[model samples]
Target: MRQLGGTELKRLHRSWRRKDSFRLALLLEDVQSPFNVGSIMRTAAALSVSELFVSGRTAAPGSPKAQKTALGTGRYLTWSTHEDVATAVRAARADGYHVVGLELADEAEPLAAMDLRRDVCLLIGNEDRGLSASALGLCDAVGYVPQTGRVGSLNVAVATGVACYEVRRQAWADAPAVDSGDAE
Candidate 1:
């Protein structure tokens, strides 16, 4: 096959972008940094995550730092801003989504072993204070990315990306197998 030219390559990439579907959503609670929000948007878009829910004073999607960090990802993904985390979680659950929180509480199950399935929403908390009791209580399940090093935690965006990828990976694995009717 002939190699594509620069214009063709651009078109191909655009087609891929156009064909992308948002399967997952990232729910941020009280995340304070615009740069972090932007970074997460970029990662979410790359992962085909459909939407972002920014709650409890998390930086708005239109901020310059977020825009700069997102590197145009904002144009490809949808976002919603909310003042109440529990309300959002309830709304998601009512919509048939299984809510999951990414926090390291005593009750949190390890991310490596968690089951990530359809109709799910992944919740992320603030940079410093972590998730509030009310927010944590709203979730159906909570998961933690195990930490073995000296540092106690990861940046909110990094943790979000890790958790998102884990859910996506598990979803891929759990997909139903297909078979042809004609046998050998």
Candidate 2:
């Protein structure tokens, strides 16, 4: 067995798009590094994020530096900019998304424990600081990625990717099985 070629990879992507039913949104709150933002944008596109909102000086995916990392995948999403996390949170909630903040807060539950099968907006904060007090207050739920490593926290981009994937994973896991007629 050999590695799948580009054609095979493309075929897989095409099939996954058909199962992309979850409504996922992301709110980047003051994630300063352009590279991080770019990487998160790539993950967001792969996981089928329907809405993206950036605020508080988070690097825009369309910026030159970010584009260097995101390539053209960032264009697959339509993201908006907001003044701050509070406003972004309000907007996300108004759009029928249950905003979940990714942080190691005192009250946060394990990320995987949350019911992410529904429409969810993940709020990620700055690289150095996890989330502002006011911003944390704005979240409908707070969740953290349970880690076994010695590291205190994950990189902003990495955490975003993991959380986004978790949301999709939950949805996919809870879905009813379909034969899809692929097997002979």
Candidate 3:
């Protein structure tokens, strides 16, 4: 077994990017920790999310602490911050994305069970508060990552990573195969 070098790593990802057919965006609502913001930014880049909508008190990736943690990965991502969650959700919907809220709220289905479409705008909430009632009302659907551990919820950043990956993994599975002519 061998690990891919930096160039090979790029090639591996390029293959997936070439085959990706769906669009995914993220909306953060009041997730205040810079480390978490930076982590989500990195994850968004890694997963090829088309856009990011940051709302409420979430930290911007350009902030010093966030940039330090993201290592400047946000430069590769397209993001915008809105005055509130509703406006962010509206922006995403205007861009043709299906808004799905990722929260542990009443009536939310399991993440894997959600009927995701080709373009998804995932709405995440504050680490402490989760989604507000009004924010939840803005979603077309709601999903939660089903957990069996002692903890009832996951860290905001970790949950974002998982949700983003799940969204792409579903789209990728249904996308046509494309060979980038590079050895894996």
For 70-141, candidate 1 gives per-residue lDDT tens digits of: 998899888877778977776666666778999989999998798776656888899998899999998889
Please provide, for model 2 over 1-184, each residue's C-alpha lDDT reduced to its tens digit, 9 standing for 90 to 100.
7676877666666666556577999999999999999999989888888989999989887899988888789879989999988889988989999999999988999988988888999999999998899889998899999999999999999999999989988887766554433432
List, residue by residue over 32-117, the lDDT tens digit for candidate 3. Answer: 99999999989998999899899988887689999888888989888898999989999999999999999988799988887675
Report the candidate with higher TM-score, 2 versus 3: 3
Give the clashing pairs for model 3: none
Q: Estimated TM-score per prediction? A: 0.82, 0.92, 0.94
Model 1 RMSD to the real structure? Answer: 5.8
Clashing pairs in 2: none
Give the range of the ten consecutive residues with the poorest summed lDDT in model 3: 175-184
Q: By TM-score, how accurate is candidate 3?
A: 0.94
Candidate 1 positional error at 76, Å: 1.3
Query: What is candidate 2's TM-score against the reference?
Result: 0.92
